[model samples]
Target: MPSSTYLTPRLADLSVSERPQERLESQGPQSLSDSELLAMILRSGSKGRNVLSVASEILQESGSLNGLLKWSDAEFRAIKGIGKVKALQLITIVEICRRVRERSPVTAPILDSPDLVFDFMRQDTQNLEIEKFWTLCLNRKNRLIKKVEVTSGTASNSLVHPREVFREAIRQGASAVICAHNHPSGDPSPSAADIKVTRQLRESAKIVGIDLLDHLVVGNPEHDPLSRGYYSFQESGLL
Candidate 1:
């Protein structure tokens, strides 16, 4: 028989200072990195790699936490170190986020200012690989009623149409709407196409008796790799 004894060491081989669990319990969750937080949920790894390494690898494989939101349960389990329980945990988190996003938006402040609007949406689209167009529909009081994603794709073509934007706004009974999109290029500067599309949507809104309040472009204004900075057309008087 081949050597039955498993010579490979386990996570215990690492010092307590290097262990995610110990560090977390001692230092608190906020002190840890994203991988450490994820590793806490994962709890274990494959025979050779430890939980922290597994979590770091998973983050790299799936991209950021936002990117992980796109993965399926099977995809999570398919990773070498993750198993059924870890996969279920990850899936549960994703479903909870989905539910959170679906709730009504009116509880928040009126999204009248472009800066406020950008803050409202940067979470969903900032680090995305592709462009995404969103509409924030608001009531007469300017409180948000619903936020909808119209389209997503490459920078050149997101296929955002006035019909899609207004149809949702009308369905949501919104008196006015705010438009927003992210530029993966990290440049918040408006493209000629961006200006043209905003004007088109504004005209359509006028005809439909719905107001187009502002259009926002999200990007990395600070040139920071980890942050998705933004720009506002209304703030710059381009809308």
Candidate 2:
């Protein structure tokens, strides 16, 4: 709907002041809308469509600019004007954004609650197309000691062993640990495998004399059935 505000069918028809690049130079990047910013990335359009229209199509396909974080190369190429090279370019930019967003804090965060855990881990999970499990080692105060990736697996399942989960935590001298993984489908609801793995971890934690604080399933709230964005094992009284 925002793209409809552009009366001209092509960027060539717009005055220099009205153009996205010109507007960005004169008024700064913040002055331009989401579609305008995307147009700048796209650079040019196909024979019939303008770059603004192509950019608008991209936004509509992804649902929002933020939604582009989860998009794959094939998804970008499915758009009208986005070819292989453009899709690759888009993928590179998206990966850069994810890296910038997921960069760990200079001072580690206190990841006590499920909300805090979700906020801390979501960016790492954002562009993942498969399930990957990670362990967050926490000090007595619930501040992070270290974060470790335990296993990487398919879209539907990840093979996690309790030893793999606790080995790094023990090595780091962590007092407690939180384990987390992403759902590629964007629903954080735990699977049978997730429940089984949590139980195994809990029992093993008792033997290892370490706390199994929580197990989180990270996902996008937009696609989640509960719209809660993430599922926590401790919150459900399973930990």
Candidate 3:
């Protein structure tokens, strides 16, 4: 068996020019490779392996840095040298990244573009361990007013309440709302339950004088709704 020492050298051991943090400080984050960026989070490795090696292993196992967010704590700990502390650290860091991405400014209005809608939703909804139903309140011009979480549940159901959905929209004085949810399975294809929820929300919005702009099912990049040809109620003339 290959000893863990076979792993890559430590970030600190590298020359100043080659270190991820040094490179990031001097050249910016975009200049670092995915493993290098992750190395900054892992910080240190097991007794035998260096941080870069552990990060590389994690990225290789996960297929990408973002993909690591999909892993549960237990799953992450099951890796060769990671333990509970490392697992929690990884989870916390990923969560912070998700939150930061979600809160980032939306300079442009979230128009009818499904891609833009997906971009906004993916910041929080993507890589979720369970299903989450959320709404984006929009003004008449389709500019984003606020994003609110309506419900959360297991893989099959988000158990969203129509009243809760509209309450925020009304409070925000939104003229319209776009409902979005995610599948942990990475498939954005709308399920029958998803369709039922959309139809319900649309009818409720109508009764409450709020327009249901669209219902978007968000998933991973590989299973992107727009790319995979998923149906939207507005586009199908069902609304």
| RMSD (Å) per prediction | 12.0, 11.6, 11.2
Which lDDT tens digits does candidate 3 get at residues 1-239? 14535456655557999888889999999999998888887777786677778778888999987787677788778776788998998888878877888878868565666777876676787468899888889998899988889888886668887898999999999999988888887777778887787789888987999999888877775665456523456766667
Ranking by TM-score: 2, 1, 3
The order by descending lDDT is 2, 1, 3
Model 2 Cα lDDT, one tens digit per residue, 178-234: 999999999999999899999999999999999999999999999889898899999
Measured on C-alpha atoms, candidate 3 has an lDDT of: 0.80
lDDT of 1 by residue, 1-239 (tens): 12234233355776788777788889988878899888888877676666777888889989987788789999898788788887898999888887787763535568878667867886886678888899889999889888899998885657688999899999988999988898887777778889899889878988999988888888775763434466667767766
Clashes of each: 0, 0, 0
Residue 33 shift from truth in candidate 1, angstroms:
38
Best by TM-score: 2
lDDT of 1: 0.80
lDDT values, one for every candidate? 0.80, 0.92, 0.80
Worst 10-residue lDDT window, candidate 3: 1-10
TM-score of each: 0.54, 0.57, 0.53
